[model samples]
Target chain A: MKCPKVLLLAAGLTIFASVDSVAGDVKVIANASVKADTISAADLKRVFLEEKSSLDGSHVEPLLEKEGRAHEAFLQEYLGMSEDDLQSYYQTLLFTGRGFMPKVLGSDAEVVAYVARTQGAIGYVSSAASAEGVKTLAIGVPSSNAERKLITRVEPDYPDTLKRLNIGGTVRLRVSISAKGNVEDVELLGGNPILGESAAAAVKKWVYAAGRSRTIAEVSILFDGR
Target chain B: MSTSVTDKLRVGAQLYDRNLGQLGQYHPSLDWAVADYRFKSWFGVRGGKVKTTLGLYNDTQDLDFLRTFALLPQSVYPTDLRDATIAHLGGDVYGSLSLKHRLGGLAYTAYAGHRSDSIYGGVAYLAAQYQVYFSSYGGLQYGGDLRWNTPLKGLLIGISRMNEDVTGKAKAINPLNPGAGFVPYSAISKADWADQFYGEYTAGKLRIDSEYRRFVHDEQDQTADIVLVEIYDDVRGWYVSGSYRVTKRLALGYYYSRYSVTSVAGGLLAPYAPHQTDTSLPANHVYDKVISARVDLRRCWNVKVEGHFMNGYEYSSYPNGFYPQVNPQGFKPNTNALVVKTGFNF
Candidate 1:
């Protein structure tokens, strides 16, 4: 008749997103004290979910933006859970003694400032936000046995009208590569359907190193107003 | 429910419904508490009242906000047993070890403690069937659990073992033979033990889990007449469940649970037959099939509706909510129940 008390560790690393875009496409930001320039999407989700406290030998903590397009974008592009689901999930972790609540800051500026001041803080911000004091960390494939194999990078185009009206967020596209290292196909997974079309068009020009077999990669692009 | 005392130390406690018996009103008491310190992931210590790590969902069972079902599989985690089953007074050594490479990680907890059962719980209700009333029941307990977060994503397996030495004191009055007066006795179990095995798998929005457990108890009642009554209870239970998130706000779940107890009485324990063993008695088993749905009502709240189809709870030596004494009208072989529950967490 006892409630089941369990001593359990969080499950293994989660495998997620791939980094293929560059420059103004930056979206994830980490404190300068963090050692890793690029973090696997799996580890990003782990840290944000409070599954693991350190990444690449550096102790790190995750911060959340209270709400907005950036917050929704981060949840969709990385954690893959709704705001309520995330909160309920956190409550599970808390009651189980598996995790503690990470600080939540309102707006991208608050997150940026907090991350800049906190030595091991990591958070997501708008692509339009200035990456002045914090370091932008690229999300990569942790399951791959090799480093980045891309030979050509194509930047997604942001429609002027959408950018001017501040209607900007993250767009995800599934990119297929042939065994011969040529781009084969691109399909929109999410984001504004129109922005998805432009993101897909740009991703189609991407080139990867030849592999033993055709490789499928998920690519995320940011169309920022700035 | 929890607060940080320092960067490395945290403490918390819970007090809730605590209805010890059917006739007992809701009594609030400190259910569980702990002062825990995590020096490292692989090494930590906790003191005060610690929840035992048994099977799959024991510790988290009290927190309804985190589950899709209105009630867990009662064949194993019975809601009536919550009084003393939730925690023990003592300390624990625990940690999560990250294994090298693809082997994944292992988490473990080992502890020794004192268990104190409530006088107003199942013990009292079960005794009422035999005309005995207990003032207290408790003793020493120890257990541990080891789990492997397998290399395969979303797969986890674990085993747990618990042992206890319990003693209870009570007074019995013969209902028919009023002249017998009140007789005091003590029930002692030197070694009672339980073992459990469980596994859980998660893929996308769907989750599946299963567990099996066995408990053995041999107790002896000693009265001032020097008469000894031997009581043996062999309990077994198992359950398998699956739940899928059908939408952002809704989830569906179903589970089947089987529970049974074969009891033996000897040396006057059974008034009609001194040394009788009834292994296949109808009162000894309960099987259940359940279906449930949950809606995420808000950021910090959820509501669950569940249906239970239960068979064979004619009566029990443990009196787990089904007692012949309580149902003078007799019991139906099969019964169904609908439950709706909403909980908040913030």
Candidate 2:
């Protein structure tokens, strides 16, 4: 009788723990017109992080809820970034003249309202503020602390105007993606004229598996003397 | 004249320009500048400069002080040395001038003048060339030379006379012995001799320059007429050539030439042969053709290897290669030669 009671008590504790985890801290919302029957965790991450710039040739813009428990959880789980790191990344991009951070609204209600008005807007809020105006999405939780994989190569019909004299140098790039994965701006840190355009073009088509549907990424170009 | 290889090496740039390219009895200009330095025990280097002009031509007496008289064989003399043969058949000697400065960030060199022999109305030349560069892991260049620098780039055009003699004071004991006879012309004779080779007025010359993306140069000279062995010999003509880069590493070039010469002498030696003595042949005239290809490959940092081939008519001189001469014999001027060179710049 004693053993049975102990087992029952342990089972009750486990149930309560699972319930707590099931109640998500933040809720992601897309425009009601978003016609996807179901979005994968990877696709949701791509949308919010700016990795995917467009959907069906339509521009995708991401919105952010102002700082709060829900905003912190969303960034940490879906973007795989701490609040401090995300701020620092934006600061770097802004000073370099690459692009700006996504627009932040004061409340979850504001995010929902913006997404409702915009054709391809995306945002996140606390589950408590979830409502009918915005379609809720399940963004993927980050498995590890690493940058999301984006674009790999540019198209073949690009110009061959400049001779690529890789005289041995490094180039750093910071990029921001829209929900549909389009690179809007680019900044070159250190490189000759040859590699700048190619790097930018390829980064624009990057599709992040982590952001699901949103991402911002930084890359380092290494020139190994061949 | 009485030095060994080691002794010559010890004397350095002094002897190299002395015996080399010894033309006829024209006096060659004598000039030399040498400097030696020794800093601490770990470093030592030598610097020197010398320039000499040499060529074969008659002497004129117009410039009495700079005359270049000739030395003929004992059997062909008109009694006195002055009246001997009374022909301009020797080289001129014009002195060479050079300067070298190697210190700090400025290393430079400048050269001017010549050395040759000629008599009566002889020619005098004023020339100079300069270059300055740095000496580090890699070298840097920022100066230009203006003397006898034919054409190494772009389009190559123009006639250049690098051969001239300067009448020297040294005299030889034997006139027939090659090394025994020293230059036999006075300063006037030397100047006259120099003048003959360069002063003899002629519209065409050995020249090279660039045009558009092509490089071209041509050289023509009228030698003496041949008697008996030929019907007509009044030599005169021009050899022209052009080169174009087909690719970054490859190039193609072509050349054409026409030469003519009078086979006979005009004065006393005319009766032996009628057509041979005719001056109507206008000296010399002949036709020629040539083609060439060049290849350049990158080897290392700022280093490149180059190779080229040239084939054409009457384009090769008897002694010197790039200079063209009119041939009396009706022989085709077809030659094939290959060359390889490596270059480095910083």
Candidate 3:
């Protein structure tokens, strides 16, 4: 091939690789117990952000990834806010001393480490990542019956510090609850380190007694300093 | 300092029914009221307002064997040491001056406040201090606060230090009198003291705080130096914070600290007393780490809950007596706390 043609082919191949990466689905994971049952998409949102403090009466903690492509996808798909909007919301919270974002880890390995070490921790990873310590939470389609069930029983608020500080704004998270009512694991779908703890602490104490196995839920925090 | 004539003042009162008398004495619920006045830069006063409280104040946290009496969750309380307990039934005075003229870009404020508590005591507190705040980013941001009391921010990192310091008489039995030695001891009339006198400056996301404090008698003295470096990153709605402390949970939130003290003659007290005492002249080196995480959640009803954890060394001494006494070895107990309070201001 001519040198010019060769250069164009190389450029085309690079573009293809980039497209392949973009099209890949970001995998959200949970503890082994989460896969044992199915949860509604709305419930998944509640679990991660701790809108619902408990499933049943047990408390659980949710986890999430630091800002990245996966985080943005999780937020867009699971949460309704964009990355810039979420950042702005968190900034307001920090100044008011309402609460801090959740702890951020660099990789899925780190997320796994956090979930394994903390009692009620949750996290997400690329489906291709290792599942050494965490389990997978089955996310039911929103329109499905399970999703409907999860929605009706939605927790109205997170039992975390952000709630204490009256922090508002939506964060998407994945949660794992144990039979004993403890948040077994967590994964951040979207949010910062400061506001993350409030969600995580509340989730760890959540209880979901009537679920078909363990469940995952998503939620949002709306701050009104009144 | 010059005094300005201002009769009308902002006033508020708090009344509590002490159903469970924490003092172990059958006492009724107490009532306290505070009224403060502000001058419009007439005379030497150039600030917005001066605040002062006058009423019966309870210093139960400083009572004899206070650690044993404190109803705090075990997580927040440290080793049980007996410190002097003084409840001021007199006055709590505060005054601040604004310096918007001196520095055009920053608004400087200087304040001095005093609280005198006396409970079955000869003398309680004559605490006094001077502090300034620079509103560098206009009035939207604040950067400095210096005071003789605990740091007063609503967050854990600010208020965790000296959370409980009841200024009064010592509770140790007199080592000289064997028979008079088993009861809570009282301080010599002139031995009352104050601590945590520090200056702090913060601009944007950084804060520098330092203090050199002393507890003294007419002839003897005990002193300490504390310094802290905190770099706060503000991310709009949420914050990520880390700090290094020179003291235990007493200084700030999740403070990893090391402390040293020098004393010619000073005693350790309980609850708020330093855990370590240096009697041989004036020097000791102590070091430790503090890990703190704080979150302020504003939900329905304006509720604020703060949690703090400190794993490090504290210097506590009950230099006065042995009765209402505390053990120094058990003085610096590991401290953890979760405080939930509902508050509002207009």
Candidate 4:
């Protein structure tokens, strides 16, 4: 069978576009004191948010660009937060004694120079910037729908009594998955409560494609009886 | 001002005016000062005058830029009572712990300290109105707070409890014999404690929060011989609030607050009612409804406006912002307040 020309061209462009964007946008840089040369997006978010202070047995700090294209891309791709929201979050942390403001720099050159000189510092700059005297870290695939491809599924068992009684409908659930791809929790979104519980029990045994961060997915199971 | 002394240690101090000279002109007072050191995720220590973490907003109340409302729920966090419970002199042990199997994480704090009241605060303002001049007001204090960040995406819940051994001295009307206009008096609290529980949920641009708090104080008074005087008080407050980020530049919020108190007094001068020795009148509570709007003028500047509709006034030494002393002419069943605040950060 031959693929359509338009479909082939579209697929090619999609691949090229993804590669281009990922390769040319932002580069994660770290100081000499940092032991890891590759960082998961999950850990990056945690460090930047002040939720975690160390990475791979070494103390670490996050430096941010005040404002720029690289800053915007990093915020959206890894942190999934707006600059405004990030600022408010920092303000809350400072006043609560949980965290203080991290160092912020002006441009890609400034970030590169500072990361190269400051111990335990981790920062990001445009891919075009020179990364002399610093380590570049590769980020894992970002969390998205692609990360939740089902690997193993447990079929829900319908109670014989309900099936005999012709009680049938679709049970909807909101599922929480851990970073390592196992189901962490499940709660009923909509459906019969009894069916929801049975469905949740089965979903808890499901597994997904491993990802760098936690993710929430919606699932539905159907029961039919005549 | 706050700065990190090292990677693991930080120090800071804050100063503020209770009210912008509305209740009365007053000198600035220290809000909090402390040095914090974190050794790990499960153990850390703080020393000096440390801030108290009672509810969702207690420690962050002064940071106006962090919230959508100009005035928080007064029933739970009264502006006038800021000095009495904001912080204590001593130390605290605090940390955050992660649990296995996606159970989420726990953050906790425990502290023991000395309570010190300021004459320039709302407590003194109310005392003056009652003709009770306090020469001293303070004592031992201790508390703890625990919060859980559950596996559920954006939900958090917490509980806090604090106990104080309160002592105070003043010149006031003798409770043993009401005929004697003024005399020296002293108070030693047998039980003074506060308990609070709070929860918050955030989904995208919308946030919802709720908290409930209860305070109890039982005191023994020092007066003329052969006369025994004691005081008992119970106060309760709670509020539920919601806010949304309507756009990049605008936000809106609303909250309902309820405050109430019950009390009994003895030979010492009365702090609330003029003629009654014990009371639980409906006027001892305040129920408030509020609506607010916030606008971000710039990345570092924002303005907040809010309106409050209250049904009653707290009529005791509780020192909630709405004090009976501030309103000598008397209080109506309903009151309204409008607030507008702006901030600039660099």
Candidate 5:
């Protein structure tokens, strides 16, 4: 009986260790000169994809680790692409003359070093890696926790015809929250246009937590006809 | 060379091979050398030699690595007139407007300038079209393009318009007297206006592209004393293409293209009969069906094999001039050819 319990504990410990190793944390780091301390995942993807070159009104550059655990995680989690697909995507951009290949380093140490010396450079590294000279950025959750809290909630009314037909989708919106927590504006980013209209109207009526200045937030609302 | 002076200011010079291994000397020339300043996401100004935004693929036709097919549909991007349609020397105003929410985006470009004629290719193509030997001087070219990237991923719709005024000197040879020197035939001027509409949809591994184009060419032939021929030629072309990405390294594509030119007086000629003296023969229309398979050998290299089944002949020739024997009864013939091409880019 004791031997069986010992075996069970050993198995539990091994599973925990494997989980820890596979779910290793990643940290987004930037040069010391960068003004922003937090970034949204969508913005991070956009920056790395070369869709936008500026962040919070400051010019910025994105660096990639050549190959490693952190590199794989960044590509999979943030960019939603495999390494090969990412390379092909970059090649397409280069051939189209829309963008250039970003600087790539071999290791986390090299990435950290490059980001430290280069102003406005952004990169990702393993959370355990030493980031002595760079600033680490926190991923912002637009509509939850410490970032912004929903005080007043307004549910969008599903269209009657759409409900009857079982038409449903997720509508993404960019909401502007004023310093006083009032919803200032809402713009539809994507979804069925008709559904987007109702979503925007409901988002405009919602209230957020007060902050020092206006903050832009991305939120998604799903309608499943229920 | 491209340098980003600031977050919103960029200057660059783009150069591309003039012939893409299809014609004479392989020389690289400037496609666009420009300074662009962006005031906002919706507005920008660019000045210099700019890529003419005349068609769906014209702006990036030279970028072989970005295209799936080894060769673009020749009915629209005819291999011979590449230089004339590549870029224009002047300024342009371009911008992108993000539609409400993330519904989609609309990009637009408008420009005006003169295009330099390639002595070997562009001039030759023009000469063949008018059925006379000619030396060309480049002319004014201007156009605008608007593309809407729909909310549906990988779907795009666009429309473009272009106008060109080309001028050249034509000379005719007397076929009956083979030994005599050529005579000054007419000073030819051609005004070509074209419009095109295109749509592309890409979903996962499947891709579809289609385009329709129409061109109107008005020509005036004149000597020092009198005008000889004044006519309008209408040409229409369209293509439907689809591709499937079978794997990470391989893709297959097929396309059907058709080109037709209206029977015009300039394209007609008198029959050999003594009683017949009016322009009567009609020019032939052309059709091409192509199938292609491409394999990416590595990150930087790709090879493509393509087969083209072609029908019809382009049968416009000078009056009383030498005619080729391919079309004996004025009926177009069918031909087939295979092409293999590889591309490497860094």
Candidate 6:
């Protein structure tokens, strides 16, 4: 009986440790000049992804930590991209002259100092770091209606030439869903242009559960020659 | 290369392959070396060799990795006029303005500068007009463009206008006049203007693009002591193109393009038999329908195979000059061409 209690305690502690590791604490911080004290995850994603230059009527600039635990966690949790992928995305933006790379700092102290001095600056850091000069932002979770679920999906056709050549890869797409649950638009985030076309055609026919407003979704489809 | 001198100011330089002189031949040149200052999101100033803002693709044309098609539609982005339309040595003011509601934003650019012409221009002039190649060419050029990004995702509409004053000189022995010594002729000295409108939409894996352009040229000739000639040339072109991404590595595209030119006969040769019979030269029109398949072998490399069904003799470089008269019976109104290209860039 005593042995069983010990095993239960050990298992409970193990579960707790795993949960804490996976839910590592991180905080979004902004300069004093920023008007909003809180931001939604969707808007945070937009700002960090360079989709919007302003948030809640205030011009916003995003900063990045060069490479660290905070950087990795921020990318995985908020941006949903890897370090290499984020770098490539910025390169595309730079080459196209659509956007510029955000400023990157070496540590949480550096990030806080820069954000304190710069107007409209926003960044992220580990919860352990002191955000004395900057304002910590409360990130809001998306509402239930904002979570669109796909109800109908159509598979894309593989081109004969590509099949014969045994070429296969994953295509990533960004889809816009209307309030009525119809797919309003789709954009190729990364992929072969020919395969992107076929994937786009099929995605256009996809139907999603109705939402209260427009929702954006990111999806990946794979094509294997065989 | 670029470095920030201050929080708001930066300087950079770009060196790229210059192929406007001869198609498929690359020459190393500085594309832009500039100092840019941004005071706000809605306004900025850039000086040095700035990319021209004439159309949707001009600024990004050199970046192959950013484009969907291996070649932009050739009717508007003609290989022969690439250098003339790409950029200028000067300054530009650019900015963006947000619209009300979820209507998106408006982006605008205004620029001015002098542009150095290329051998391609001279070759095109000689081939089309008088089989006399110009050795040197240069010009002053200016342009502006405006784009509206609508509330609808991935939809943009734009308009652009440009003006240029060009001059060219060449010395060549006239093959038509065998005994004549080398004659020096001003191949081009004219004022040219162009206007264009374009729209693009991208959704899911589908992309569609369309554009229309018109060009007008006023020319004056003083090579002959006995006569001075004045002429006007009008050209129009448009294209509609669409592409689909079938998978991560393959995309298919199709487009239809049309081009036409009309020249008013008012030069020293106006009294010639046909010039007198027709006030305006016969309108030359060309049509091209193309289908292409592109494969992305890697993140930075792509290969494309394209087939073109071409109709009309309007694009025969010497449409009104050498070819029509040299091989009157050999002119083919319809033809086909295959283009295969592999491109890689960083």
Candidate with top TM-score is 1
**Model 4: per-residue Cα lDDT over B125-238, one tens digit each:** 776765767777888999999999888968999999999998877777765566879888666898699999999998889999999999898877676443345667788899
Chain B only: TM-score of model 4: 0.89
Return whichever of 1 and 6 wins on TM-score.
1
**CAPRI quality level assigned to candidate 5 from its DockQ score:** incorrect
Question: Model 2, B192-245: lDDT tens per residue?
Answer: 111111111111222222211111111111112211111222234333344454
Q: Provide interface RMSD per model, one decimal.
A: 2.6, 35.1, 19.8, 1.9, 3.0, 3.6
Candidate numbers sorted by TM-score from highest down:
1, 4, 5, 6, 3, 2
Candidate 2 per-residue lDDT over residues A65-163, each given as its tens digit: 778877987776666565544554454323222124678898877888889887767777765463457766432222233444443433311223332
Identify the leading candidate in terms of lDDT: 4
- Candidate 4 — which residues are off by over 4 angstroms? A1-27, A37-42, A95-98, A127-130, A138-226, B20-24, B173-183, B224-228, B266-281
Over the full model, what C-alpha lDDT does candidate 6 score relative to the true structure? 0.67
Model 1 residue B160 CA deviation (Å) reads: 2.0
User: For each candidate, what's the DockQ?
Assistant: 0.21, 0.01, 0.01, 0.26, 0.15, 0.11
Better of 1 and 4 by lDDT: 4
Task: Report every candidate's CA lDDT.
Answer: 0.73, 0.33, 0.32, 0.75, 0.67, 0.67
- Scored by DockQ, the top model is 4
lDDT of 3 at B129: 7
Which stretch of 10 consecutive residues in model 4 chain A shows the poorest summed lDDT?
Answer: A8-17
The runs of at least 3 residues in candidate 3 whose Cα sits more than 4 Å from the true structure, single-residue gaps closed, are A1-226, B1-8, B15-32, B41-186, B189-258, B266-288, B300-316, B319-346
Better of 4 and 5 by TM-score: 4
Per candidate, the number of residue pairs that clash is 7, 132, 122, 2, 4, 23
Which sections of candidate 6 miss by over 4 Å?
Answer: A1-226, B18-25, B121-131, B174-180, B187-190, B224-229, B270-283, B315-331
**Candidate 6 per-residue lDDT over residues B191-241, each given as its tens digit:** 789999999998867889999998887665444342234556676779999
Ranking by DockQ: 4, 1, 5, 6, 3, 2
